[model samples]
Target chain A: MSEHDKNTRHLARMQRKKAVVDTKIESAKISKGLLLIHTGIGKGKSTAAFGLLARALGHGMQAVVVQFIKGRSDTGEEAFFKNAANLQWHVMGDGFTWETQNAENDLASARKAWDLVQACLQDETVNLLILDEFTYALKYGWLSIDEVVAALKNRPPMQHVVITGRAAPQALIDVADTVSEVNLLKHAFQAGVQAMPGVEW
Target chain B: MSEHDKNTRHLARMQRKKAVVDTKIESAKISKGLLLIHTGIGKGKSTAAFGLLARALGHGMQAVVVQFIKGRSDTGEEAFFKNAANLQWHVMGDGFTWETQNAENDLASARKAWDLVQACLQDETVNLLILDEFTYALKYGWLSIDEVVAALKNRPPMQHVVITGRAAPQALIDVADTVSEVNLLKHAFQAGVQAMPGVEW
Candidate 1:
């Protein structure tokens, strides 16, 4: 064979080897124990978290969602997934702490809700645990940061946890494996338009 | 009662009325320009979009999502939500023309895909439309960008569109009201662990 042909073949072989190595590297990811904190002043923090829950359910994975500071007004999420076998929905506490007053009382209820989530995490039956709007509790000093971190650390080795709300605590940020901040630049409502039925809710 | 007590009581009542008014304004928001596009080399774009479908369903609002290039994987989000009176799931296209070499054949299939979504955009029954991986087609020049934009502009007044893919056209970026770019900075896989079943699926 020719010298040029030999060099060309050698380069091709190297390229193929590199690609195989890359794929192998990608396929070996930890693939479990993901703790996601979606924060910042964006409107879609909760929306993004719920989007994750839906993904988990579609894959036949179990999801336990505990919604804090959002127990009223009947958010449509519950109405639709109420019957889905893989979904466990718990809405505890009044719409907001100010509404329920006694921040101390609200804190106890938040802790109780966390306890329910802990059972799912410990049971290893839940694939995804979404603590929707839990950041407010941390911000208001209703939930102990150490307790939250400890429970999360103790989650089933292969399970994932997603916490969504604005102003996430630094403590939560420190422990999260994946942190995404959705910053809201502009919103439709601010532009004098109302959220239409299907898209907004 | 003293005059001071009367003044304090009056101020408190006015504040309560103001609070009620603020909440009404907040609840009255209707999302029109809000759009969600999922573009990444991840396993969950369509899964995320479908989850949005369930959310819209819960709210009693209509949803119309056009699945592009994924007609074969049809595991049928259509079969799941199509029967619901308020849900409109449109799955168009026959897998993809990727392996097909002829330019004419590719364009022909693209045209077919466009036809289904184009009509749905006009129908008022459709509330939200998801263009799954449709961006890749346009990026590859199989579909015309002009035609796509025209369809988007001509859609129902309040209709929201969600486009997902790895590389969406520049025109799309210009037209999109909200765009989120998920940058893959690091992956745990490089270290070595296979994606866990329920977690990574």
Candidate 2:
């Protein structure tokens, strides 16, 4: 090949490399003081959300996590991170939602849950708010999406909120700065297995 | 409801809870060891991975981190983690794959990279091994998956390993007793933004 042709080939390769680099460059800027909602049927919605809380804590960002459906379980994550000086962790739910039936009871508990969330959202000191399993309230029709979104929109500026659960509403998706849909390709439960601690919880 | 009926309901609830809990009791002993790998387009994989390393250090677990792909970045994580007497940190790859696409060079770097991973994996003294961007080797076909798997499977049997990245392979997934996937939804890029310190990196 001619020297000119070799130069052209090099240029093309550079372009291809830049394309990948450009995407990375673009994504790096996506979550500046972001508001993220994690929803899906797959497991680990809570786990992944907590993972972010760890990041925020590592950076000295104050984080508050509200566990809507996991209030009763002795979560390993709670045992590990709840005591971090920068983290404000609350196991503020009445265990799983399946155990709670009466709409009155659920909403009452959600209100209590929302209070803790509101405190975190409004607190200038708290940089990250993890609303664990908050979506299930909307999915079960126990909480109004409009009301929740309004609360989120009106949240104190610079505060990032993370919602974790399945069936995130379109309105939620619309307002979210970032949305991660975790698909369940395969889970141990499908094979007649159960959650394994340190791995599952 | 009558007082007797209320008592009966409460007793039944407790009984049900115990039966469910009994079946779910964890018999496998929980071990505290550490292995961390950070990779992906996301901002904090390395930071978050190292946060866990710090936690391990607090627990007095032996740690060694080898930074691949991001060797020259000199992230604060490297500076902080390396200062701890219990932690060992190495940075390699010089800059990036594109900066030096020579296969022989990449392999040479990878061999050096693997040397650290292999050392931590084998030396019974080191309890935690952080392989930042370790998966890039597998993704690029520079390292065989089976070789990596065998090393991981045999690594200090009780040691805990964390692999963080996008697009982890099926083989890794199979061997991972615990596999957590982080998803991305709404990012700041759509709004034209950048990552600030302590939040991004």
* Model 2 / residue B58 / CA error / Å: 9.2
Candidate 1's C-alpha runs over 4 A off are A1-31, A97-102, B1-35, B38-48, B69-110, B166-201
User: Ten residues in a row with the worst lDDT in model 1 chain B?
Assistant: B182-191
List runs of model 2 lying over 4 Å from the truth.
A1-16, A19-32, A72-74, A98-106, A188-197, B1-67, B72-96, B99-105, B123-132, B178-185, B196-199
Report the Cα RMSD per candidate: 6.8, 5.6
- TM-score per model for chain B alone? 0.69, 0.79
Candidate 2 C-alpha lDDT tens digits along B102-197: 545676788888877887788888766767777777787768899989998888765767666666788877776544454566666556666543
Which tens-of-lDDT digit does each residue in A121-150 have in candidate 1? Answer: 797877888898889888877778898899
Q: Global lDDT of each model?
A: 0.67, 0.65
DockQ of 2: 0.21
Model 1 Cα RMSD, Å?
6.8
Candidate number achieving the greatest lDDT relative to the actual structure: 1
